[model samples]
Target: MILHAGVLGLLVGGTVIVALMLFGSLVGVRILRTWNPMSTSEEQLILERQTYLVSVLVAVALWIEIGSALLFIHTVDDLHELFVGAMCATGTLNANPVGWWVLAAKGAIVLLFPIWLAVNGLDQRSGSFPLVRLKYGLLLVLTPLAVADLSLQIAYFGGLQPDIITSCCGALFSESSDTVTGDLAAIPAVLAFPVFLAVSLLFLAAVGWARVSPRPISRIIAAVLSPVTLAVGVVAVISFVSVAYYELPTHHCPFDLFQSGSAFVGYPLMFSLVAAVVLAAMPGALLMVTQHPALRDVAAGSERRWLTGAAAAFTIFLVVAIWPLVFGNLAWESM
Candidate 1:
């Protein structure tokens, strides 16, 4: 099965990551927790090197996760032909409870990896590496999550039965359906569209203002932008993504976008928004590295660059998402 192939890749990648993380966690608890900055001990030197090694491995593993997420979704979309009632990736995912759990795990892994990178960045900037324990401890925590992700992938793919019929996106995401997605779909475009636009603009404006503002003010804006960006992502589903892909204002089903030509924009647009949030949120590393006054400048410089990157990413998302409505010659009707 296509899903089996995808799950196989995840298991391989996740197992390697979990092993490295376990080592890192052991070092954190037994050595790094008590190591001295001034000690010229052999153990301290080895611990430092081991830390870097774990980081390199984890970073590579995280990169694999990003690719795996896309591959998983693509495989599901491709399997629609084989699935008795699947019309797209969404339908395939709706096939069983395990499917949604797999998706949740994928989302968590993607989101967590960047935060791990931020933690590592904080440790890198600290002269004494005070956050070493925190970083390794986090790695330990994430190890279980990665394992769960692997387990969920196996369960999802294993549960898939070609003989069993499943509901398509049309039925699962329809207005009358009793799902959370259905409720979101039922939100009239009249309201959802404006809210989506307003939220996006607010996010854009806040991040822009943050670029030039003082650190405290910029941090506040960053704090607000987090939730706003999340809201924008949600509305993008029920409003922009659904409408653009389906070419029908009322057909607010996100899965439909992964079908045929619409698939071109679906994942790319979603990825762009996610990238924007990841970039914009990097300045938060400051909270972890504040012990080192020297790193304040480093944090400031990184914040500016990352927020600018966020803006650029969001701009790309806007262009890609609206292209169908403006230039793809999509048929549209008044909301």
Candidate 2:
């Protein structure tokens, strides 16, 4: 399994990303120690050039990181057939539980990378490069995570064995099971559906308020609600939205959303949610830099765009999530 093309590709790509991150970290250290935007000395000149180079390198790596995250999911899902009783990516993950950690790490990297890029972008917009040190310090902080992502991927893929019989999603997602996922699965659609709808609407309203008013307090409210909405959205998917997708009241495996038979609707559904989360967080994230006069105008302009994007994303999420329930043959009484 480790020799699989997708597996090898991810490993190679991850290796390259880690190497770039390591190099960036070294540059980051130098930047932290000696960055002086106002100085016109040759050393400062060299540092300026290096900062641009490192930024581009890191940006490319982060973009790859996003692609790698999606590929990781596709690869794991593709590998499910090798394990007995395996039906989806969940089974591949069950084959080596560490794969779950790999998934999580990839998710974190994907979420953080865009935020970092946003910060770097805002800094570049300023003549002083005011965020140079902060960006590099963040780079240093992120290097370990990149290293851990690669390491965990190695551990996961290397540990997979054809002989390992994994439990299918049905076993884990069933209400009769004791796991947290089971608890989510157990949540009655009657209850879960309403909760999901309400939370999503509230999130939309908050984001709308921010977009219309463009106040710090409003943006903060939208930002704070964003993650909460994501959490509830996941739970809603597990609880009822997935059932609608599968069209079977008892079949609650969220991983099945990526399967071909479902037209891979999960990809867009998930992308919408993730995009919403990232965009929603940006206004508040910009808040951190807005305290500096140089960033205030930039942040102000960016916040409006962010809030608008976030509102659109959340709306798309709601529409996709409820599509099955509203149009499909699935029914609450089926449960």
Candidate 3:
């Protein structure tokens, strides 16, 4: 595993991120303890520069981390050509459970990074805003996870044996198998599709209503529904996207969807869902924003963009996920 190009990339990227984040944690500790935007001291000025500088570095590091995750998957899938028994990424990942675990950890970290950026934005634009320490504290908390994710990546790559006979996607995803994959496959498409659509509509309604009314009541409604929307989004991926990609109700192997033959369509659908959720949830998150002059004006514009982008992405997901079912049904009728 260490010998593979993909594994090397992942290890190198993860190592850099850990180092940067560790440095960030130290800077964050200082910032949290003595962050004073108004003070004209040399230390305050240096701290401000350090904050912005580290933020940029962390942003790049996070992007690299995300790319490393995708690369890891692509690498695993590519190995199928070399392994006689492996047919898809599922087989490669199944060779070592830690492979996907590290991927998942990277994903979680990437998602949370945006929120930290948003919080940092609030603090930067508003000198007196109270979230500085909290944001720094979050950096500290995330550092350990970054370290662990890298360790897991290293362990996974070190342990994976290339020639081992592995259970391919068929066995792993077969509905007859008594596993979580099978349970997800068992979800009735008729019921799941409707539920997914309903949740999406509800999420849209909440965001739109909040935007129009701009009241605490409406904001609260959106905030409460955001998590529900994310949950339904997951169900939709499991029940709808997986089924459509494989064109088989009994096969729900997500990693297999990334195979070259599939044109990697799963990438957009999955990432779009994530983008939509994060963007849709931003307005609700902004409710906690302090009433600072710089933030007040800019926030409105940011919220508008988040709303527009979220709505667009959601629409894309709905269309892409439904196209297969609709066309397949039509072809069935023709047959």
Candidate 4:
């Protein structure tokens, strides 16, 4: 199983990403300590050139990090057949519990990498490069996370044993199970669906209003509601969306949506959700820099574009979630 093409790809890609980030962090530290746009000395010129190289290196590594995140899930799902009780990515992850940590690490990168890139983008838009210090500081923080991700992946793949009889998704997702996933699965669809629908609509309204109006309050509302909406959306998927997608109310394995039998619907379902969350959260994340006198005007101008993109992404998610509910034959009952 360790020799699988996808597994090899993930391991190699993770290693390269860590190396790039490590190099970038070394450069980042120097930049943090001595970066000054006003300095015209030879050392300052050298630092400027180094910053450009480090930025490109980190950007490439982060882009691969995003792709590797998705590939990690797909690889695990593909490996399920080797484990006796495995069903999907869930069971494969269960076979080697350390894989969960790998997933967590990858998820963190997925969430943070974009925010960093956005900050870098905002920094590049200015002549003075006002956000340089903040960007390098953030790179230093993220470098450790990249190292952890690789370490966890190595630990996970190294420990895999096909002989282990792991519990399948059915048991884990069933109400009889005592795990958090089980609790989410146990949520009554009738109740969960309404809450999900209400929150989704409200979030859309808030984000849409922000995009159109671009007021401080509207942006604040959208930013605040973005993560809340994503959390609720995940719960709703576990509670009922999966059920609707499968048309079997009792089958609630979210990973199964990625399989061919489901027409690979989970890709679009999750892609839109993540895109919506990331885009919607950008304005809020950028708020960290808005207080900087030099970045205030640039942040304000960029936020409008972010808001516009966020509204469109959120709409895509809403359409994808609602499509199955309306068109599919499954009708929610007590559970």
Candidate 5:
């Protein structure tokens, strides 16, 4: 029964991601055509507008995905029961094939959209917020979030142990029994600190260099951001390590590590971290758009029209997809 439920939940979750990706790709392609002409001025405006709009859209999507993931995690036990019943009714559960193609498609879409936005957005001629700067800033602010996440993982998987005392030093020590699980499961917490620390130091160095020299500090700021940028590179390595070393080989069930009650509590932290990063970046990006010469022209005329249209279309799509779930009927009474 439990196995069946796990499979069912995985199917539903994968379906949702696939739907979102299909819609998002259509939106991306439409936006891309507007820039086919690719003039200096038009291209700059298109990129800036797209950056802000896409960031906002992704932030919204992430919030929804996190919430759904948590809910699915919490209700995993019930799902397991459902799975068992289905298998019993059908007689041959082992022959059923899981949808790996859907999973791969969804993953590609989710990852590619952000890279598309970041590359086009940052590559513009105007001296807007460098991609490096925003990346580093995100790293610094999410540090505490990372630590809290690690602690939670330790609490969840690692069983409690009695405190140990050293006879010579009279020091007490304890080890967490929390075993790491899925790659995605550990990321929000573990990566937060190092990302934050590297970025903060770079920003501080930029400020110091500015005070000491008469030259324009943007180049210095960009330079400081370069090393911190390497943190993004660490993501793949960490994810691989997490899956290879932390996850159990046989725990094919998606929700094995998720606890429903704890999900509502823990999931909110993930949303909060993402929201913080977006909120912090938005104001500066907005200010930069107004001040940067190349961007100023893009905002002036019909170019702004196309940008606004694209943003509005994307927003409408999100509203259509999310509103029903948020306000729709509940199956059970709340505690």
Candidate 6:
């Protein structure tokens, strides 16, 4: 009975998440179209309607995929165990040509949505402000987080050894045993020190750059980047420590709180927290800068509004995309 309830919960939750992702994609497409520079008025109207129709289809398809994944998850029992089960299921499905075709089609839809947005949404030049430049800057902020995430993956794959020396030796350390627990405990301390130092230096440099500029806009840019740098730094420190030192209990799943191996909770928490903090800080910083002595002197009324609106829109998008993870109960554990 408990198992059935758990399965149902997963199905409902996963469906909701898929719905959100699809909705976000649709919103992103609309944002892109609104900012599109080259479309004729008639063309824009037609595309807008088409975008809505495609969004509805995407939403329905996402719900179906969620149902499929949930069914698969329930059959497997363990979330981590599902990877192997999925592979076995894939093998069985491969025996049926029709099943293979169906799976392939679903896979294509899942993969294509993001690709479509990246290629089409980014290629066109649009609004007055430099969308590409802002996008690139966002990428820069995101890169470190990506790298840190990759490092966690590597650590997990390598196995949970506490000492860097032993971890390098490729031994599958036990989470329950003293030797393994000690090793896991040491990981966070080892990983965090260097990351924190580097991030702090970067923040100092940004602050210095902002101080040198006499304009409020420059200060505002600095302000926006500063908190982001700090948040990322905090996440990196937490992840570095958590991945290096934590150990899992022998009887329970490795994902449980006591487990040294599961980064599932820590990773998403850090990612969402950092993203949220940076986004929350962006608008106020932009507003303050626009009203500053340097910007006010050089810009006309129209230009100021354009710059402000562009900055606000970009920040809002960032916030909306990551808002679920931060405020909603959809962290790595849920995934």
Give the winner by TM-score: 2
Full ranking by TM-score: 2, 4, 1, 3, 6, 5
Best by lDDT, which number?
A: 2
Local error of candidate 3 at 212, Å? 2.9
TM-score per candidate, chains pooled: 0.90, 0.97, 0.90, 0.95, 0.30, 0.31
Indicate the residue-level lDDT of 316 in model 4: 78
lDDT of 4 by residue, 183-259 (tens): 99989988888888888888888877866764567767877888898889888878888888889878888888878
Candidate 2 colliding pairs: none
Candidate 3 per-residue lDDT, tens place, 214-309, comes to 566666777677678877877677666777766665666777667766678777777777777777777777676624455777677666777778
**Per-model RMSD to reference:** 2.4, 1.2, 2.7, 1.6, 17.2, 14.1
Clashes of each: 0, 0, 0, 0, 12, 12
**How good is model 6 by TM-score?**
0.31
- Model 1 per-residue lDDT tens digits across residues 22-140: 66566666655666667789978887777777778678778878887887788778766767888787778877668788788888788778878776876676556766766777787
Task: Please identify which of the two predictions, 2 or 5, would achieve the higher TM-score against the true structure.
Answer: 2
Question: In model 4, which runs have C-alpha deviations exceeding 4 angstroms?
Answer: 291-293
lDDT of 4 at 257: 83
Off by over 4 Å in 3: 82-84, 127-130, 290-294, 329-335
Error (Å) of candidate 3 at residue 15 is: 1.6
- Residues forming the 10-long window of minimal summed lDDT in candidate 2: 282-291
- What tens digits encode model 2's per-residue C-alpha lDDT throughout 45-93? 9988888888888998988898898888888899998999899999999
Task: Report the candidate with higher lDDT, 2 versus 5.
Answer: 2
Candidate lDDT scores, in order, read 0.72, 0.87, 0.74, 0.84, 0.33, 0.37
Candidate 3 lowest-lDDT run of ten: 326-335
